[model samples]
Target: MKILGIDPGLRVTGFGVIEKQGARLAYIASGTIRTPDGDLPQRLKSILSGVGEVIGTYRPDCAAIEKVFVNVNPQSTLLLGQARGAAICGLVQADLAVAEYTALQVKKAVVGHGKAHKQQVQDMVQRLLSLSGLPGTDAADALGVAICHAHSGDALKALQAFAPALGGKGLRMRGGRLVG
Candidate 1:
């Protein structure tokens, strides 16, 4: 399965593609989309188009994106949320299933801790993907999101396989968690 991971920002959005072959993950591509220093509408449009181009190029099976984190400033948080919404719009337009992960969840999945710093995440991403050099901070976070999805996908498959044995308890998983 090929997965596209996105980290959305008004000025710059990061994207990474990874393929899951059985139990192993291989990196395909990683890059950043830089928006012009202009008005907010143009910036939002850039994000939407940039994300759409990525999906068209990679043709990933699914996409995972970082959820917006609340900032101290309400306006900042709202702007971040808009950026995320634009990214998600691109994914949904491509008819792809989208998974949202919080920063804490992504950090824990990649670095084994929610409080890991940016350098740690970049190092871990390099190690996991066997990259020669460290990816940029935003790109590393994007790749980390993909890696997180890969791990969660495996667990979800396992759960689905065993769900039947749970006596048809009406259990189901949505957004990587089990529900009944």
Candidate 2:
């Protein structure tokens, strides 16, 4: 499966593409979508268009976005939310499934700790992807989002497989878990 991961930001949105085969994940491409400093609406348009172009080029099977966390500045958080919305819209327009992961979830998946430092997450992302050097911080973050989705997807499938044995649903899970 090919997955596109997005770390949405109004000023610089990062994106990474990864292809998963069997138990291995391979990096395809990664970069940041930067918008000029200007009106909010125009910046958002740029993000949407840039992300659309990426989707068209990669045609990924799915997209994983990092969910917004209201950090220090409310204004910045709102802008991030808008960027994330645009990113998701672009993916939907491309007929791709969208998945969201929290910042902590992404960190934990990549670095094995929810509160891991940014450097640690970046280092682990490079190691997991077997890259020679660390990707840009934003790109590494985007890749972490993708890795989180892949890990969560695998766990979900495993849980589904054992759901029936645990007296839950049959082969599929509803509301994120199986119920018999």
Candidate 3:
């Protein structure tokens, strides 16, 4: 499966593509989509167009996007949401399934801790993807989102394979116990 991950922002949106087969995952490409910080509509248009180009180039099976987390300013958060919406629309238009992950979930999946530092996440991304150097921070975050989705998808597949044997509810204790 090929997955495209997006970290959306008004000024700079990061994107990463990865291919997964069974237990193995390989990085295909990664970069940032930059737009000048003048007009909001223009920026969004640029993001939509750039993301469309990526989808066209890679033809991913699915796309993963990091959900917006507002820390300080509401206005900024709103703008980020708009950018994210544009990205989602672009992917959906390309006929790719879109998955969303929270920043904490992404960090935990990539770095094993929800509060892991940016540098730690970047390091892990490089190591996991076998990249010679770290991608930009935003790009790294995008890759982390993709990695999280890959891991989660793999786990779900494993669970599904064993679900039927466990119980009709898909969660039942076997040998004198209750399993969820």
In candidate 1, how many Å is residue 75 off?
0.6
Worst 10 residues of 3 by lDDT: 169-178
Residue lDDT tens for model 1, 1-180: 999999999888999999999988999999998989988999999999999999889999999999999899999899989999999999999999999899999999999999999999999999999999999999999999999999987877777777678766545666666875
lDDT of 3 at 36: 78
lDDT of 1: 0.92
lDDT for each of the candidates?
0.92, 0.89, 0.89
* Model 2 misplacement above 4 A: 171-180
lDDT of each residue in 32-112, candidate 3, tens digit only: 999877888999999999999999998899999999998599999999999999899899999888888899999999999
lDDT of 3 at 154: 72
Cand. 3 TM to true fold: 0.91
Candidates sorted by TM-score, best first? 1, 2, 3
Clashes of each: 0, 3, 1
RMSD of each: 1.5, 1.7, 4.9
TM-score of each: 0.95, 0.94, 0.91
